[model samples]
Target: MTQYWYNVRTHQVEEDAMSDWTQLIGPYPTREEAEQALEKVKERNKSWDPNDTDGDGWADHD
Candidate 1:
């Protein structure tokens, strides 16, 4: 019962943290497959800018 998590803010694949905010995107059997899916999501949302200092773009919410 492997699980995968994605950071929507950074659009990066994260190891299973199982937190309240980790956002479970998939429950794949293999880590490779989970990473692949994460890559696809990144591709679709290529404009993700996680470090916009001006606050006009994605903000680092923690």
Candidate 2:
């Protein structure tokens, strides 16, 4: 299947890794998801925030 990538340097969604890997975000399943890459990153960063003092990207204690 074809893949999509989010180009960080150009802030564009590409059909594939047209640029360097260091400048790309993903092999997202769809263009829509690739387009929203930054938002997804923001959400993830929030989840992993150091000050979270909670889950912080770690497994939760049951």
Candidate 3:
């Protein structure tokens, strides 16, 4: 079975584990999920940011 990864730096899905941790987000099960990595991060950050009041103290100006 092939593995998939989302390249954080390039914003692209990789077919195998070819990138370093600083530039990647996943060993996702499918290419579709890998492609949505940025969306997933945004959704997670949205939920986490509100509850993370003690985190960084930056407000969401959006």
Candidate 4:
């Protein structure tokens, strides 16, 4: 299957790991998902962060 990556440096979706790994977001299955890499990251961070809420990188963990 073809995997997609989001290039943080250029803010573009790539078909593969054409650039440095540090500058990439992920191996998302679709281009649309890759395009929302930053949003996905934020959402995921909020889910994982013990103090994340309201997408402010901090939440009321109570």
Candidate 5:
């Protein structure tokens, strides 16, 4: 099976893990998921942002 990644720097989806780690978003199972990387990230951030406001708890804090 092939792996997919989202290139953070270029906003492109790739089939291989060829970019730097800091510039990539995932090893998603499908190309479609990788293509919607920004949306995925935004969704995740939205879920986490509220918790971060308290500056406590799990302390993931961004």
Candidate 6:
């Protein structure tokens, strides 16, 4: 079975195992929706750093 993964922080979509654990920012079925959701998350969290020294490279809300 194929699964989809979406990053609430970056709104990046992919086919991976972690998709199940990821928070569904929206019921979005399209890439644009996911992108919009990611933007919303970014806007809500101003301190989020998309580029960090961490290996994950995920933006964190401080």
lDDT of each: 0.58, 0.83, 0.80, 0.87, 0.80, 0.53
lDDT of 2 by residue, 4-61 (tens): 9999999999986889999999999999999999888767866766654463443344
Please, what are the lDDT tens digits per residue for candidate 5 over residues 3-62? 999998988888888888899988999999999888777666666666645443233544
What candidate 6 gets wrong by more than 4 Å, as runs, is 1-5, 8-11, 14-18, 46-62
Residue range 1-62, candidate 4, lDDT tens digits: 99999998999999978999999989999999999998878777787887665666556676
The candidate, 1 or 4, that scores higher on TM-score is 4
Say what the RMSD of model 1 is: 7.3
Query: How big is the positional error of residue 12 in model 4, measured in Å on the Cα after superposition?
Result: 0.5
Q: Which ten residues in a row have the lowest lDDT in candidate 6?
A: 52-61
lDDT of 4 at 11: 96
Minimum summed lDDT over a 10-residue window in model 5 is located at 53-62
Write out the backbone clash pairs for model 1: none
As a TM-score, model 2 comes out at 0.76
Quote each prediction's TM-score: 0.36, 0.76, 0.73, 0.73, 0.73, 0.34
Whichever of 1 and 6 has more lDDT, that candidate is 1
Report the alpha-carbon TM-score of model 5 versus the true structure. Answer: 0.73
The runs of at least 3 residues in candidate 1 whose Cα sits more than 4 Å from the true structure, single-residue gaps closed, are 7-17, 39-62
Clashes of each: 0, 0, 0, 3, 0, 0
Candidate 5: the clashing residue pairs are none
- Sorted by lDDT (best first), the order is 4, 2, 5, 3, 1, 6
lDDT winner: 4
Ranking by TM-score: 2, 3, 4, 5, 1, 6
